[model samples]
Target: MDEIVRSNCTDRMRSYLESGCSLHYQNISNLRHLHSCERELEDYINEANAVLKKLQRLVEDAYDATLTANLSAVKVPDYSTADSKMNHEYHFTEEKQEQPADELDRDSSLVTVMILVHNMLKLDYTMQEKIVRSLSLKSSSAEIESYRLMWDLRPYVDGSVMDLAWKSCP
Candidate 1:
């Protein structure tokens, strides 16, 4: 659940108890209360979106920094070597002995993985937004409850993947 939802949430259990069992949401104000809640929810989501965007920019900057640093250490292949023609055709360069290729490869791979994780988070948020927008008077109690659980649990976000992403972060 979002921090806003957790902190500023209304007394939902109390409200549910106050409403009589014979009533249907569609027959009443058509979830006007819930509509207001949705707006607040959207505001929280927007805040999160902004933060995610910022995080992505930071990751991109880090990747660019590492790339530039590594690029500076590369040396053009010696044209006089017999095998130079075969390797130079691909424009591959040799890394300075001081900077091991494995370390650079690890940095590049980390950047790629973080990017993939960031995209997954973006997609997850998009799905959550769609789910929030889908709520209506016609929604059954089961459906509404399902939506609540889905929003709270954020099933689209893989916990292990997120943990891995975090673990790899500098």
Candidate 2:
């Protein structure tokens, strides 16, 4: 009876050790899973930051184009002539005509629109290149799709629309 009791206790101890080992293995697996999740989250954040930076650059480019358009539209009208009398008369009238407030506003608006269009053109090119480069870099499908949309809008952004706008306005 004493021997039998000793044998039973030994068997119980072996089973307990096996159960503890299995629990330890499970804990290790859980930790590995957590680590993998953290890595994936970090990757997502980095991708988001890259996209945001690209978008900010595009906005800045658009703003610059608008400023250029406005400046170009405000050029003084040239009235030079070979006739001395006509030149004097032209100068006299030119000096008297103060730019109307509405004219100034119109000029500003036109400039803004032209600039916006130019910016769009630049964005189209930039986006196209970015998309191609990203594809080469093995970027995900979502990023490629975003760039494709920008690429498709390029034609309208060309100066032709702005030219038409000016023709229609005047």
Tens-place lDDT digits, model 2, residues 1-170:
65765677676566666686356667789879866765664565567557756755765675576556556555655545435456557776555545544555665566566556545655655555455445533555787676667666655366666675567465
Best by lDDT: 1
Q: Which sections of candidate 1 miss by over 4 Å?
A: 1-32, 77-100
Residue 114 lDDT (model 1): 77
Residue pairs clashing, model 2: 65-115, 66-115
Q: CA lDDT, every prediction? A: 0.74, 0.59
Residue-level lDDT tens digits of model 1 in 1-170:
46765576577744654675335655456568777887897897898789889979978897897788689657555658747576654444344453567778778877877777887778778877787778776889999888778778876677887787888867
Q: Using Cα atoms with residue i matched to residue i, what is each candidate's TM-score against the true structure?
A: 0.60, 0.37
Extract clashing residue pairs from model 1.
none
Please report how far candidate 2 places residue 36 from its true position, in Å: 0.6
